[model samples]
Target chain A: MNAQFKKGVLDLCVLAQLAKGDKYGYELTETISQEMTVATGTLYLLLRRLNEEGYFETYLVETPGGPARKYYRLTPKGLAYTQSLKDEWITFIDQVNRLIR
Target chain B: MNAQFKKGVLDLCVLAQLAKGDKYGYELTETISQEMTVATGTLYLLLRRLNEEGYFETYLVETPGGPARKYYRLTPKGLAYTQSLKDEWITFIDQVNRLIR
Candidate 1:
């Protein structure tokens, strides 16, 4: 796969996943990596970018079974952004589908 | 749409379009902008980035009816990169589709 293209959408996918609930970096990375092969380093870099962009806010939260994890949660802006991305992706894919067909 | 997300995919889309044939910056921007709203500045920046990355090479081509235009053509590396992107996108979308369904 094109690592760069995968890397490009990684941020949006991470934001979309966090829209459901707060998740720590490792958990998020694991979840996405399960669906698509992604390196921990790439995921971490994207998480940092999202945090820096103010799309996500992070805090240390203790888990019952383990040490405190840095949980990432989406802000209102992030949710809105995700919705827009979904819409655009649908439209873009629809067009591409027609062209290919 | 999420401007940043749109911005992220714009580069790939531009490269894909150029895979069909060589096109000048304005023509490429116009072609993509027909399907997706993109600013001229943004398209130029992407073109410049692709050129800098050596994925594309540009040269001036004269048309019978108009002034010479700068045409952008993809290198072999660019085609291979585009193929990789397409494969990754297919896999990623398939996963997302299954999840949504």
Candidate 2:
């Protein structure tokens, strides 16, 4: 995948994943990495950035006999942002597919 | 559409268009603008950046009784880059569709 191209949509992908439910850094990375190549370091940075931007809020959850994990959840702002990105992506692919096909 | 998402894919879109043949700035913008929102200024900047990156080369075409139009064509490097981007896009979309749907 083009690095530049991935840079464009990675945020939306991560946000969409979080919108489904809270996820730890590793879980989020694993889910998206299943669909595409993504660096765990890069994802962590994005999570931090989104948190600072108020799109996500993180909380630590304790698990029995395991370390507490920081899970990410979308804020109202994050949900709204994700919805807009999804709309844009759908419209974009629709147009591109029409043209290319 | 999400500006960032568009930013990721617009270069690939433009490169794909050029790989088909040469195109003027207006023509390129008009072709892509049909499918997505892009600022003329932004496209121009992208053109310049791609050119500098050796992904595109420009030439002036003399049109009868009109100003010379600047047309863009893909260099060998540009062609290779476009092919790679196309492959990545196809895979990315395929994965994303599966995940999102």
lDDT of 1: 0.71
Alpha carbon lDDT at B70, candidate 2: 92
- For model 2, report DockQ: 0.24
Candidate 2 local Cα displacement, residue B62, angstroms? 2.7
Error of 2 at B27 (Å): 2.1
Q: Model 2: per-residue lDDT, tens digit, A1-101? A: 22233355777788888777888998888887787767689888988888999998889999897789899889999999888877776766777666554
DockQ category of candidate 2: acceptable
Q: For candidate 1, list the clashing residue pairs, or say none.
A: none
**DockQ (CA atoms), all models:** 0.11, 0.24
DockQ of model 1 vs. true complex: 0.11
Q: Candidate 2: what lDDT?
A: 0.78
Provide backbone clash counts, one per model: 0, 0
lDDT, each prediction: 0.71, 0.78
